[model samples]
Target chain A: MDVTNRIERALTEALSQADLAGCPPRLAAAMRSAVFPRGARVRPRLCHSVAAACGDDNPATEAAGAALELMHCASLVHDDLPCFDGADIRRGRPSVHKAFGEPLAVLTGDALIVLAFQTIARVNCAPDRLLKLTQVIGSAVGVPLGIVAGQAWECESEINLAHYHRSKTGALFVAATAAGAASAGADPEPWRMVGEKIGEAYQVADDLRDAAADEDEIGKPVGQDVAHDRPSAVREMGIDGAVYHLKSLVRGAVEAMPPCSNGNELRSLIMSEATRLVPAKLAQSAA
Target chain B: MDVTNRIERALTEALSQADLAGCPPRLAAAMRSAVFPRGARVRPRLCHSVAAACGDDNPATEAAGAALELMHCASLVHDDLPCFDGADIRRGRPSVHKAFGEPLAVLTGDALIVLAFQTIARVNCAPDRLLKLTQVIGSAVGVPLGIVAGQAWECESEINLAHYHRSKTGALFVAATAAGAASAGADPEPWRMVGEKIGEAYQVADDLRDAAADEDEIGKPVGQDVAHDRPSAVREMGIDGAVYHLKSLVRGAVEAMPPCSNGNELRSLIMSEATRLVPAKLAQSAA
Candidate 1:
């Protein structure tokens, strides 16, 4: 199966395991909806591509990719809660909290996080490698310098925009690359740069979209950066400046690709994804 | 250090790691408050005791125990959210959501869960044992049959009380025992029963306190089962009957200890914990 299909199947199976005979119907249903009718599946695909570049297509790689996607999906669910962005729509559908109520939404996010780790645990791999994969992913998901710290930045009255953006948006992207490498028994440290650049570009794109796109175009609330007083490239720099920065980060991602047998293929993948990350709409808005 | 002190030191270190210079102050504070002044710390203690019984008093076992406590603490924070039980106080203080605001509370819970796995991954053990430790704890925290499922039971209109209680409360206890055993290179399966019985007894004790004790006595709101219409042993079988069940479960925990060189010591530990689990207050209330 293709990477997206594999991720979808893995996610579906994970949710099914939670939806056993006496499982709460709404919680089970929300878990499925939170992951399915998916988003871009960017992180998982990036992970898979990196693993392929490293010359291993093992279950560890697939599992790592799927787990990364699950964590991404989980972040979205929690981010949309009333206490956070309070977004009522996600990927053009009712948000988990909106559809199933806030309690179920909270539970769904928690369950998905657990499922991510559980999925990684089940993968067939060298135990040391598996432990490394878990650490890389776990650090990206948690605090200090992870996505959780990124979101927590909003709670602060003052913040450094660069650090905030990296932790919130760049951490998982970094995790995806590092975990993919670790899963394939390659040096994970070099891949961190690849993830950081992609993640920075992705965050800039998100900022641009939030600043310029309509609710219909974005599939969720727009102008959230302004509404939430969040730190964003579009807010700190103008739309034009943000676009320029995003393109630079994209180039950085391509340049950061470590030497490997599949280096050229990975570069092309990164370039194609860069265009998607900073789409024409962003350019049009900046123009 | 004793288990409680060791667990506290480990947790303090974990939170400090997340409290980097630029980390959001409120998020950092909330994470600390969510775990400090912890309730009984039963899960971590159980885990440490089991690991000791299995003849491994290594850092890996300490890490596993701390991780379990972090997971348990995370659940408590989320469980007390406005959308769930909505309790204003936990462990005799303002709950995380109430003290730090809802957004911080949510983020605090998320960061702690991630911290749990990170702790285990950092353990100084053989790769396979660390992997097993992660799996054992992850399964207890996630869906199909973890604490997440336990909370999800409330969303369902109907639930088998036995399954609800087990998943909601017993799963973590089971993980504590199983993880402790795994950390020692011992077979983990045999230790599961010890956890289950202790967990079941703990739940019944909880139900008894919620049903019969005053708010001051329990350090939180009382009568929550009736208020939320949750499945409870005390509610299902009257307080007296529930007390009887608690005693029986305590006895089962004693009998369930697997044979080891430290069998006599472990049995004594279980009996002491059993008394604590079913305190004299429960007997007085039943009378």
Candidate 2:
């Protein structure tokens, strides 16, 4: 199997094991209903992309890939909690809190976050590389920047999109880019700019879908951002403008990506992903 | 200052700087409340003890000390959520969720977890050492073992006290012990066993209190464990036997502590901590 598919398969195995083994029965039952028709697995894809970009290897790519995805999953669970988004629906099912009790939902999210770090640490990478990856990912998850800030936006009026997106959404992507490169035992600095730019594009596209996509198209509430007055590229810049910026970012990211067998394809995939938000193929029946 | 007082002082300083600039308003507010009457600063005490034993430099000892305590605080916030302990009170005040509402409570807990890792990663230790510290701490927060398991236990049945205490309560203590040793850059394995044993003793004392103590003594609900039918040391061993086991483990922990300048004192402290849990205190209070 190609690297992307291989990682997805591995992730499914790992996630299922996590779900089955440590999960409380109520939680396991809830997750069973919530994880289907999953989103694009965008973060995992990025991890695998970076891993392969760096010449796929053992300790680095596998650990980084699993760690990033686990973090992403944890974020989703928390975001769907009644407190933050109060999102009752996720991936087209009742959210974690709605299905499991709110407390278990909270603990499950906590578990996932810890699992992300555990996945990374268990990798056989040199202690130093594992250490670097842990810091990078940890910084993304915590303070001034991390997912915590992203959720905190709901309570505030003024928003700094740059900082918000950077830590809240972009941090993990940056980690994926860096982690993948590091997995190859190579310094991943060159990929940093690329990761940042791609993350920007990704967030913008998310805004587009949020503003215009319907439930059928997006598989979740649309215009929820405007409804909540949360941050979004469309709110900052109109939808058309957001698309233009996404294209610009895609171009920048493509240029920043290192030369590799998958580099060009990765660039194209990212570009297409940027436009995937259009309520287009997703609303096929409407079309 | 003695290690405990100094580390507690240091922890206060650390919490002040968190989110000082551009912090999410809700996050800042909740974080502010979460730090009040912060628990015993037990993790910092353990970290400092390990560092003192290993001869931690001024910088290493201070950084690891602050980081470990933050993790403990974060875990406590999550644990107190209505979903986990449904604990309306902690350290004699309304728990984080009770004070802030569920959403902010979730965000604050997430932020603290991230902050714990960020603080350690940003600390001045060699990147390798910093990485080691964060990874160890991160493991203590998540998965097959950790706080998540502690929370997950509520959802699973046939409650296993050994595993529950190990993950929810012991992991951080274990991390604190390992972190203490790591400050001096020692091999962490030797200290792990000592921390684990001490952590178990701590849990046993907790069980004894929960089964027999009154609200004024522990400052929280008494007998909640028995109410929940949760397996506990008291349930497992009965009162007198539990006390004896706690003392025996303390002796083992003292003997096992990494040898250092403060070894004798740490042994004494551990013994005293266990001793204070004497059934006499509960009996006197009841009388």
**TM per candidate:** 0.95, 0.85
Instruction: List candidate 1 stretches off by more than 4 Å.
Output: A282-287, B278-281, B284-287
The best candidate in terms of lDDT:
1
| Sliding window of 10 residues with minimal summed lDDT for model 2 chain A | A278-287
Quote the lDDT for B185 in model 1: 83
Candidate 2's error at B252, in angstroms? Answer: 3.8
Sorted into a CAPRI-style docking class, model 2 comes out as medium
lDDT of predicted model 1:
0.84
Q: Pick the candidate with the highest DockQ.
A: 1
Deviation of model 1 at B287, angstroms? 11
lDDT over C-alpha atoms for residue A129 of model 2: 75
lDDT per residue as tens, model 1, B205-237: 888888877777768988888887777787789
What CA RMSD would you report for each candidate? 2.1, 4.1
